[model samples]
Target: MRIAFIILLTLFYSCRGVSQSFEGAWKGDLAVPTGSLPLHFSLQKGDTWTGTMRSPSQTRLDFKLNVIEVAGDSIHLQSAALGMSYKGRISADGEHVEGTFRQGNYTAPLRLGRYDSTQTVKRPQEPVAPFPYNVKEVTFENTASEVTLAGTLTQPKAPGKYPALILVSGSGPQNRNSELEGHKPFEVLADYLTRQGVVVLRYDDRGVAQSTGNFLQSNIGDFSRDALAGLRFLKAQATVDSTRVGMIGHSEGGLISLLLAGQHAPDLKFIVSLAGPSLPIDSLMVLQLYHVGKSQGMSEKQLAKVRPINRKNFEVVKSDLPAPKAMTQLLENMKSVGGASGTLRKELQVMLLEPYRYFMRIDPVPFIQKINIPLYAAFGEKDVQVPAKENQESLVANLAGNPQSRIKTYANLNHLLQPAKTGGLQEYYTIETTIDPTLLKDIADWIKGL
Candidate 1:
């Protein structure tokens, strides 16, 4: 995960006559309109006060509150890299730091207390040790790429030729657990599925955790090859019913399933998609950006200025122009429209541009139309990243030729399939439930039916 560099940490330093006991761990939740973000601060006292802040849920939030000032009861910390300044008043009891977190024209109330890891929301469904199912730490080869992938294969103890599912993760580098904010959604899902007479393969992404190969160089197709390798490995196993093997993927993983289904090889019995985009990636990305900005209360006028710049950038990538020429055109267009300024922003743009070029060009309609296997596609009604309405409409429209396709939209669910009000990515970490129970049951039953 790339660091946002836009810091949201608030800390408190000791004022003269205010207790030295105030200088330890401090934590706060920055409540945005979408959801709450947890901030952890570690303070050390030397000749001066120094501290680092961490956003446990997001890796992009590793920032130090180096510039700190303490005078009387007031504390000031500035991180220009993060484009924010925090000014808070430490309570006399040295318990809380009440402050206003300011960045640009936006200001929000921030309250920091003695740091507590327990403030993290609970995930009740996460599995514990001594599980009823047997779990094996297995390693398999993505024979096409010569990369060895490591993952946990979970199956029921009494299993005999059990139906199996390969769990594919979303975008970004993720572990076998698919861990985020102390929640292991994949672990929970795998456990739930395995307990219900289904075997599951949940692996780390390429170059992630124990897995090998350079993840930065891989596109969606590379990941699908890895997943297909998992399927082949499972098929050879005596305990797995090769004829009933299916692939279930989340987000980009879901898109990978579509890519694999078109192959019609290894005889994929079924495929399940969770919040997969049905439209072309370029169109989906445009809507995704718009939805996210709107959810965060961005004005339509502001969107009008930004949307055209985003479209032009994608167009340049899609064009026949050389990389240098495309980049020049993209930057010139951004400058002309008064959008995406600064050295940091431009550097990030260039860095991310190449990695998504293949994804941006993927046309899923052809893939869906060619798939002969039974398909179960689920979308969260409130998902902004892959809007439920647009994706579902496209899925039904494109897969109309496929008589075995099943498409559904879950109300009040977000991109993560957690029950949500706003469907914002920010809300993902805050919600206690990882994947909704009904959704899990729906997926399991569909796979079983196939």
Candidate 2:
């Protein structure tokens, strides 16, 4: 599941009275407890100074600076959509900007220097061309949603019927590769599995790149229908063994897999849930807030004060009241949070969105308990986003009826399945490995055995 309120730092500069031009590229690394998060900015000076900032380690999209101000030697930049801001002082040499990055209550030191285009993050596991598999760009219609979904189909070159898997991405706007944090996880996984003689199909989420739909307006049920459409399309392929078809979901996708299987989707023989939750979503979210906040250096005292408020806010979200009423209750509940007014308002805006409201009301334990198909669920021991222990225990207890199910947790792995030190989100960009080799092998082996 996507952590809705988390914000990454960005770059900022002043256009007035500086010896050197701040119109080119600037780069910085925000130092956090886990590691450094690289941020980039491309600034342009014209009739009005305009700039765009990129968080390379988190996402490739550039956020437009909503506000930029200059006072003496101080530079301040803000992005209202991101709930992020930066304040810095330009070095006398004009080659560096030292600043403090703030997002909500979190703050960290950021030092930016003139960017060199030659330096780029390396992702060793991303597959290159000249593969031993056949790749084809395909499109299918989710007639139920009237959305034309696009995806990639990879099959072994040997051309024999193989066990098929449809990859479902986590919450957020994702392409066929499920790209994030400068990493294309679904692309790498599809390549690995296809090379292992399995037919793999990975699609862009509805309203994402190459797909047609309104993403922000859609909910989880809409995505589940889209995945079902992919499954039907895969089963019709000549190189796929329809009886052996299954789904491999990550995060929210994992919850979708359980939902489909619990409803007994046709021709779906097995499922693999990576960092999927089996607990009530409200409880899971509260746990997520606690763990992620602690990992980001939130004190015990602060966390204690925030916990009950968050729970009450979630209760408001899950209620049957209309949106306006729900939002009023959410705001009233947040009065106790007592943070910066701007930050509180930004966070309330997210909670009032349709997706957050629907997600908070869902309890996946009932769906997990109803599944009888072969299931393989894995978690990262260091994953703060999902908090491995409690989720794993819930899955273990609820899935006892399914004797074909298996659950395992890998030590030192994060939500993305990369080997990590602190399991914090910042580490996702720094870690070079896309997915753990062992986990890949485990997934392939389990599916083939089934």
Candidate 3:
């Protein structure tokens, strides 16, 4: 598994004795759906004013753009990476700036005040070690489309064929390492499992890493084909014990794993889920938005509006209407409620629009129940990404009569199987560690038992 490269550009600005119009540090806050978050805009004069802007406490939010754009009292910054944009006016003192934050279908008026840049600067975490395994980077064709897939095969270092397991990544355009927030869970897991005498195979999702395909164009069903192809690759490997082969999926990967086991059931021995969603994804996302809004203290009346507006935007995508038009209508509904007290309209708006089209149609029950393989599911109680209760409840409810299925719940762990403090997104960025060793242990024990 290869780690993704970090793009860090150090931009230099010219300082003049005669002095330029806009220079020095600019501090402010951007209003979000939940509340206002601090934004640090460090500007230096040259051809253009530029500097990196970070959120308060260095919240690991995906900003639209880190570069600062200054035009006299008017400041314009856009983060294409995060699909967010900001436009505001800087105070005459250059110490404060107030503007509107725009993301997809939502917009909010944001205010910011000047602050010292010397305040404690928090650094990011170290990358995790790759799972102990003999590795091979390979590429092959997608028989259906004849498109080549880039992937890595991590096997036990010792000789002799071993039970092989295919690793499936979670949501988003993930590479072979399953990199997220500077953590490479696939490498960590590959290393852990291989050392324990299991041969593992993990590949890049199409359109990510060296693989080929359009991520935005593909849906969950398309991803399942990729997983099956990976499995096929493993079965063809001379060093793998095909009879004992299985699948391990995390988050979205877990859902895919169930699909593979259910439909193909291709000599698969077992399956494992790490923090995967078992409920309908739309419902889960609604719960996420509601939880986030409540965490920021939205009142009952405000929440009432939040739910339906959220549901309409999310559910409408699955309707007969076109996705783009459905999304547009959803945004309008959100704007109608944006003025409500304590509601983060822009955040909800953006949140509702992008992920809605991808997740609204995903229902994992059909796949989960149809799977003939022995299933093992694990979730961290503190996980906010996939609510612990929702994941466990739905998985259990689906497998209620299936005695062969096993489920375990871990307390104080986050989505990545790391020990967590309430498992909030902030902790994911601030706290540094690969994953909890205990999680690895649980996985190994379960596999061995199976």
Candidate 4:
């Protein structure tokens, strides 16, 4: 995990009224048009504030907004770490705040209010780099598609043809930077790998950064195509040893890597599955649903009722019926099978519906069984997005009949390969840093051995 820099962190220091008491631990939900998410605001006197957000499922984590600018009752924060900026206003009593979060022209209104602090505390001492990676970034074109893929291709300073790896981001329209909060994991990985005598190709996904395409409208299949295109791009490069080219995929990217391996691409040499799931899409999605509900303190009985509804609704949406009609009915049934009366229900609805449909419609088994490449699958035991046991077990079982697959489960690493306590996403924001160095070493060593 590369430590992204804080461009600004002062709470309205640039504005008047330097005496307001926006100096306590404030917590609330960021109420968006689609749903609500837990937003934590920790304020320190002298114009310093840190913000962290968690998804409804509480698995995906975001970063703490650096350089918070608060003016009187208004707050302005810009996270260059994520190339995002936000502006909102708080009530005089420090009770409520409403503002818009902006990334380029994409903007969304966020509502946050004060709350009681939980037992969770920030761990500033956790192991992480004090500064982000230092590397040269470059851009190249996809000759076949005419799409420009921006990347930071890092190589060892010494002149030599090094083994190369392409870094593929997980779900979401990620830039080549893999900008999580403000941290750029891909940039950091490229630098670290290059320093270890491994060349790395980290590029923007389609529809993100300098790449051309509509990322929001893309699916796993489209992402897979993009990954294949990346592999081809790397293979054609004069500096990259075509036979030594491999892929390092995170989260959904890991699953795609499995599919790529299964396809048995002739140029592919190795694959690293980081927190990838082997189970069917529907089953994995249901597990995600349950995990999110549990994090929000849902009761066992409530989960029992909600779980079946989730699985069934997804099944209905994936049926051969028309998509528009199926989606309409799915929403109706979700509304009927309700949970407690509050923000959680709305959040859960968003969590259960979108990704469930996305994953269920595709199957990776056919692809998983057909691969002839050297396979490496690993997971953080603490990962909540795709639990270690369920994801790795199914993956191992599929590879059980295939003798070439190798698997490892890290006990203390999170989805980002960061050394973590319980490996939860919350730790990502609360702890300042990139992933553990050992994990990086493990990856570098594995690539070298190949």
TM-score of each: 0.77, 0.81, 0.72, 0.70
Q: Which candidate number maximizes TM-score?
A: 2
| lDDT comparing candidate 4 with the true structure | 0.63
Q: Can you write out model 1's per-residue Cα lDDT over 36-119, one digit (the tens) per residue?
A: 345666666789988777755444356888687777777787666666778777777788877777756545556677855446
RMSD of 3: 8.7
- Model 3 TM-score (2 dp): 0.72
Q: Can you give the lDDT of residue 198 in candidate 4?
A: 77
Query: After superposing candidate 2, which stretches have Cα over 4 Å from the reference?
Result: 6-41, 45-118
Q: Compared with the true structure, what per-residue lDDT tens digits does model 3 show for residues 1-450? A: 000000000001111122124455655444332123345555565775555555432234434346566655676777666577778766555555556777676565565655565655332223245545567899866777555678777777667878789898876666787765456778778877877888888777776657888664566677777777777888888888777788899887887777676675666778888887788866776776665454445566666665775666557655656645664665566565433222233333433333334556768788777766678888988776677887798788776344566788898887777787766655654556667788788788777666
Prediction 2 global C-alpha lDDT: 0.80
Give the range of the ten consecutive residues with the poorest summed lDDT in model 4: 1-10
Judge candidate 1 against the unseen true structure and give its global Cα lDDT, from 0 to 1: 0.73
lDDT of each: 0.73, 0.80, 0.64, 0.63
Which has the better lDDT: candidate 2, or candidate 3?
2
Over all chains combined, what TM-score does candidate 1 have?
A: 0.77
lDDT of 4 by residue, 69-129 (tens): 7677777777666677767776655566656656664444455656555555443323254
For model 3, the superposed segments whose C-alpha errors exceed 4 Å read 1-69, 73-132, 296-301, 324-332, 339-358, 400-404
